[model samples]
Target: MREEKLSVDIENIVKKWEGKKGSLIMILHDIQNLYGYVPRATSLQLSNYLEVPLARIYEVITFYHFFKLEPPGKHLIQVCMGTACYLKGASDLLHELRDILGVREGTTTKDGLFRLEVVRCLGCCGLAPVVKVDSKVYSKVTKDRVADILSEYEQEAAVK
Candidate 1:
């Protein structure tokens, strides 16, 4: 079953958009912010509330990276593989993360603790070799540091 909190959140968004024409996009954005990904329930609910077709809702959800159909991991690891980062062994870092998480790029680990992604750039060229773990940024990454960096998250997960 889906969490009640998510249902409550969707209800709130629907209420906020009541009688407000052209609020579909805003409501969807708020919904995505509340939940890391846009669950199927939310999409259907939004469609019903906005009088929008499910196809349109699905289109928007798939078009944007911010809206995910599936649940995301606790930690979203984005490795910047831009020209600068690539020159600085960003690919190696990506491989190390995949090895540690046992998931390939653009996929979440089975444990759901981590998702590995390769992005074009994180706009931290000066700090080439950048990676974003959830909202935190790590620069100057090294192959040796991968285990250490991931170990910290593993320890946190253990405590949880």
Candidate 2:
């Protein structure tokens, strides 16, 4: 649910990557950062600006897991599944999330409040079972704590 379409103005972005090797990916990264996703219209504009084929732009976007084709939810919940976290009950945390949010991994909730993703590591193994909500990292998370974590964001969104 984003309401805005692709942006038509990308002159600055194009110029920054001008003449650089693999500028397409760099340009796409900036576009995603600006809009949270790569809009089809914007991609077309980029194609015309760079004189690169539309297919090539899409190829790069599709190839990278970090690039998104659609707008993301308000909050991104990343559960670290690193060795320590897994051993400490990351699987249970994932299951708890599925039950509470009614969404599968790598998907956003129906209300667009939260998106769940499982990351390989967050570099916080000492605090196993880490659940990162946007920029905030919840260390030593438990299956039971999942509800509390989500409710915090939900409440914050409601207040705003």
Candidate 3:
């Protein structure tokens, strides 16, 4: 039933962008926004519906950084790697997070609690060594604070 709904949604999106130039990217963006990641099955369905090849779909998906082949975790941890942040020990914070979460950058935790990523900047240069979890930003982050910050999220999950 869910698959059917997804197919319908994809079809609607395709229809909405049909006959337009540069529609494939737009269609794929809609799919990604809807499902968090593009499922292989959905891409296959899109290939058939749009009369485009599966290889072409995969090419587009892989070419774009915004697209994800796998689903992300509940919380996204973005460590800033800008010059300001890097100079302020952001690398240590990232390493500490990997140790505490047991997941490398671009991968989610086994418990599906966090996904770690490194971004060039978060636009808060004044707050160097910044770490953002979901929508909340932690400034002046330190390696020692990694455990405490994660504990806060773990506690929230437990309460829920």
Top candidate by lDDT: 3
Per-residue error for 92 in candidate 2, Å, reads 1.4
What's the lDDT for residue 126 in model 3?
99
Model 3 Cα lDDT, one tens digit per residue, 1-160: 1233346788788888988977999999899998888889888888776777889999999998899887888889999999999999999998899888888898888888899999999999998989999999999988888999999999999999
Best by TM-score: 3
What stretches of model 3 exceed 4 Å from their correct place? 1-6
Q: Which 10 residues in a row give candidate 2 its minimum summed lDDT?
A: 1-10
> Mind giving the per-residue lDDT tens digits that candidate 2 earns over 1-160?
2233434457788778788877888898988998888888898877776778889999999999989886788899998988999999999999999899999887888898988889998998998989999999999988788899899988998999
**Over the stretch 1-160, how does candidate 1's per-residue lDDT look in tens digits?**
2223436768888788778877767787887788767778878766665668889888777787767666678888899999999999999998888887888887788888888888998888999899889888988988998888888899999998
lDDT of 3: 0.88
**By TM-score, how accurate is candidate 1?**
0.81
Model 1 clashing residue pairs (backbone): none
Off by over 4 Å in 1: 1-6
Candidate 2 Cα outliers beyond 4 Å, as residue runs: 1-8, 18-22
Least well predicted 10-residue stretch by lDDT in candidate 1: 1-10
Cα lDDT of all candidates, in order?
Answer: 0.82, 0.86, 0.88
Candidate 2: lDDT of 139? 95
